[model samples]
Target: MTFRLSVERLVRIFPAQGGAAEPTRAVDGVDFVATAGEITALVGPSGCGKSTLLAMIAGLEPCDSGAVRAGAVTVTALSAEKSALWRRAHVGFLFQDAGLVDRMRVIDNVMLPMIYRNAKPRDRRAAAIAALERLGLGNMIERRVDGLSGGERRRVGFARILADPRPLLICDEPSAGLDADNTEEIRKLLQIARADGACIILATHDPELVTVADKVLPMRRGQLVAPDLALRAGAQQAAAAS
Candidate 1:
């Protein structure tokens, strides 16, 4: 079944850290609709809640209040086991660090998700190889993930995302630390995924990557805000940190 991701008044709060008195609203009443076959980019600096929001949508994190729906399923209502099953069936999440098993061979890492989904061993292997080859990583499939460069590791992670081709693809800073060439490579892969009719939501600070998105949601202090305001706040935060 085709799916559209809908988040309604989604909220998540965390106890204050360090010297803070009030709890932090990690995601504050975030409501948005991301359609199938379109890319939605969440643009913000660190700690703006993009990652938390994505996690909630994917059922990886619990919501403090509100609802998350992916087509007919109420994501917010799922139990831990059901959430895992739901994610395996519909969501492909790419985290900032690529999240590979460092000591494993690249192909094995790519096949991990398929194993959980109970795909046949031979079929999963073939799908993994095809995905790796599509990402220009066919030659690296036998190499240990720990031995790969940063760009190569990220590519392997992307390969894993492609292996099963779930309907919803959520990525967190898929291009965090890479050279120009590697960044462009990721952009192309995102384009390819969109063409395959996946609902893609990505959290990123990279303006270049943002350009590829069909819609850009600028976030600040855990809320969707005006683009200029978000940009200014990000700038101010950067200055204060420096």
Candidate 2:
């Protein structure tokens, strides 16, 4: 099934640590639509609320005020239990940290999402193997995740996305901190997902990946802005801090 994402007036505020500091408006009244069969790239400098916004859309973080709609479902309004269930059914998240179980075998880690969605064990195994093989990890399927390098772990995480093929794929810096080859590998994987008609939304600073996007949403200070304006805002903030 195909699903489009609609984000409306999204807001997330973090209170000041002490009485002295001002509150941080992580994502302030952001709105956009990410259509299925295309990729939406959120481009911005670090600490510009890209990750926070993705978290809210994924229902991994609560919104201060706003609504997230995926197809006909009100994502932000679902109960905690229901939200989790809904995510397992519809979302494929590729976290920046390469969220994987270090204690499990590589193949098992890739199979986790399929398990949550109750895929047949035999089919899940096949899909996991195919995904791993595609990412050049077929030989290490039985190896423990903790033994893998950072790049390997990240690739394993991508393999999970390949195995599940969820309608809504939310990726946070999917190609961050990788060599050219690995980054290219990730780009190919993302392209494959787009071709398969997943509504792909990713937070990235990778220009190569940006070139593949169907739409680019540039952000600054938690709000969408023109590309040039976002660059100017980031430069201005840096000069002020200096």
Best by TM-score: 2
Regions of model 2 farther than 4 Å from truth: 18-20, 234-242
Put down candidate 1 lDDT per residue, 142-179, tens digits, no spaces. Answer: 99999998878888898899899999999988887777
- Weakest 10 consecutive residues of candidate 1 by summed lDDT: 176-185
Query: If scored against the real structure, what TM-score would every candidate get?
Result: 0.92, 0.94
Error of 2 at 201 (Å): 0.4
Relative to the true structure, candidate 1 reaches a TM of 0.92
Q: Write model 2 residue lDDT over 1-242, tens digit each, in one string.
A: 45779999999999987774889999998999988889999999888899999999999999989999999999999999999999999899999899999899999999999888889999999999999999899999999999988888888998998898989999999887778888888888888888988999999999988988999999987998987887787799899999
How much does candidate 2 score in TM-score?
0.94
